[model samples]
Target: MASVQKISTCLWFDTEALEAAQFYTAIFKKASIGRITRYGKEGFEYHQKPEGSVMTVEFTLDGTPFLALNGGSIFKFSEAISFIIHCSDQDEVDYFWEKLTEEGDPAAQQCGWLKDKYGVSWQVIPVEMVDLLNDPDNEKSQKVMAAMLPMKKIDLATLKEVYVRG
Candidate 1:
């Protein structure tokens, strides 16, 4: 059989997989929910749920593949791996920063790292950040990094000011 071209990311939710998927799909464009299969009696788990309950809930976020599973709530999203959004300008950064940062969860870090409401990490970086970081002057780049360290979504103008000072 020919290999199918498909990509998927599995998300473990504490019995909130479907709700989370719906919330996410509604926020993003070109995204929608997929099939949600419930558990059957034969495969059901004794303690909580059936064996097949929410085996997989496939969906997309801005064309990116994703799957939400109704798994235990032992683990939640953290600051380890984050989504990097290459923003063209401040408006784009503000847009994503405002939307993803609902629910009063907003923390800023250096170099464009932020924690959203769902505890999911995000990086709203300006496209110019690459060039700034790659500057030949180590001191200049370091200075810019220092300024960025305390920021949530990077401000291009502020970064430029720091870069010029170096």
Candidate 2:
């Protein structure tokens, strides 16, 4: 039996709820689309969306449940919130960086952070980064921070090299 999640993150989109859910599921392992809800006639007066249009899409990404809502253009995505992908190695980091940035804005790329085609922000970071940044040696941590500050897509190999050199 599947256990229920007490909380789930919700993503707001301007009529791309279903598409975004599908796209996210395709990218993450162990992910799948679940229930889909459409706007009903009862809420037409307030929502103003087409009654039959998608209202929400439930999905799981790497086992974490999420909801995508077609909430109209009144709200827009901002840099304040972002999903972080904790990559295990260079391969994982490279894979996410390439896939997520395929149709994304190149101008928005900075310090391992990117905005996808859907305008959703993501941070592709190596799991080892935490340890490197938390090192007891301040100089070592500073070196790692310097190497990371100028990178768009995180280079795990380069980070590792800097850590060793320090």
Candidate 3:
């Protein structure tokens, strides 16, 4: 069966399209690198990338297709957009938190969000957070939110503790 993805994400990198794709695919279990396009001498005046150098690399991460473009240093990633990974438990949360935060922006670690080494922001959220936030008891939800606000790597145990203490 042929699968089609009508919508996919495109990431712009200074010059690390291949490197970033490899990094992401290595971290995610179901990830893989696909087609790679190279630049030619025809566009040297504009792209400046060496002839035959990587221009774009198509990749799939955890089943989501993404395109990484070596678009030069014109555009940089910001915190406005982030990928969220809903972990089923603390172990899952910790695994992603440790992997994504490697040599990343330590200061950006807050409320389950962290910037990866490639300056890509990711949120390692516990699956229970959704239910906790949607809880009918506003007080419990508020407490959980408040506790999570000050955390760098969200502790599922702490959130669970707060909920049960109520």
Candidate 4:
């Protein structure tokens, strides 16, 4: 028999995992709720708390697996790790930048990085960025990077201007 295969990305939240999951499902398409397992007697005994609390909640966003729990609100998501989104052109980059930054913190770069309202980090990068950065002249790439270091959504026009000036 062939084993079932599933790809998932786990997120750690400070007691807001469930709420974040709900928010993501609502914002994206092809999303829905899945299995929800409550805390059992064993867990309660171990944690010394009441039963029926959220032990785990599974859900799918755009067909992606996500698990949420009622873990105490202590830790939070930060910029140490982020999801990178590759875009085909400026339009795609702009669109994703607009949507992802709606309730997130924007960073300064040609490749975008933001922390969402739920504290999840994301990197929205244009597909052509590699070509621009891989120019034979390192000066061009350096200039582009420098110019992009202060922008939130990354203006492609500015990056191109920097590249041409080199």
**Highest lDDT, which number?**
3
Candidate 1: tens digits of C-alpha lDDT, residues 49-97: 7666665687878777778877677789877778787878888888777
Query: If both were scored by TM-score, which would come out higher, candidate 1 or candidate 2?
Result: 2
Candidate 3: 10-residue stretch with minimal lDDT? 157-166
Q: Write the per-residue lDDT of candidate 2 for residues 1-166, one digit (tens) a residue.
A: 8877998899999999999998888888889999999998997888999888999999999888999999999898988999999999889999989889989989889888999999999999889987898999999999999999999998878887999999
Sort order, lDDT high to low:
3, 2, 1, 4
Global lDDT of each model? Answer: 0.74, 0.91, 0.92, 0.70
Give the candidate number with the greatest TM-score. 3
What TM-score fits each model?
Answer: 0.80, 0.94, 0.96, 0.74
lDDT (Cα, tens digit) per residue for candidate 4, span 40-142: 7886655554587666677776656778766666566667877776777888778767766776654423347776777677777776666777887888988
lDDT of 4 at 149: 74
Give candidate 3 regions above 4 Å deviation. Answer: 1-3
Pairs of residues at least 3 apart in sequence or in different chains that clash in candidate 3: none
Q: Which stretches of candidate 2 lie over 4 Å from their true place?
A: 1-3
TM-score of model number 1: 0.80
lDDT of each residue in 14-132, candidate 3, tens digit only: 88999999989988888999999999999798988999989999999888999999999999999999999989998999988988898999999999999999999999999998788
Instruction: Flag the better candidate by lDDT, 2 or 4.
Output: 2
Which ranges of candidate 4 are over 4 A from the true structure?
1-7, 26-33, 47-53, 59-64, 106-111
TM-score of 2: 0.94
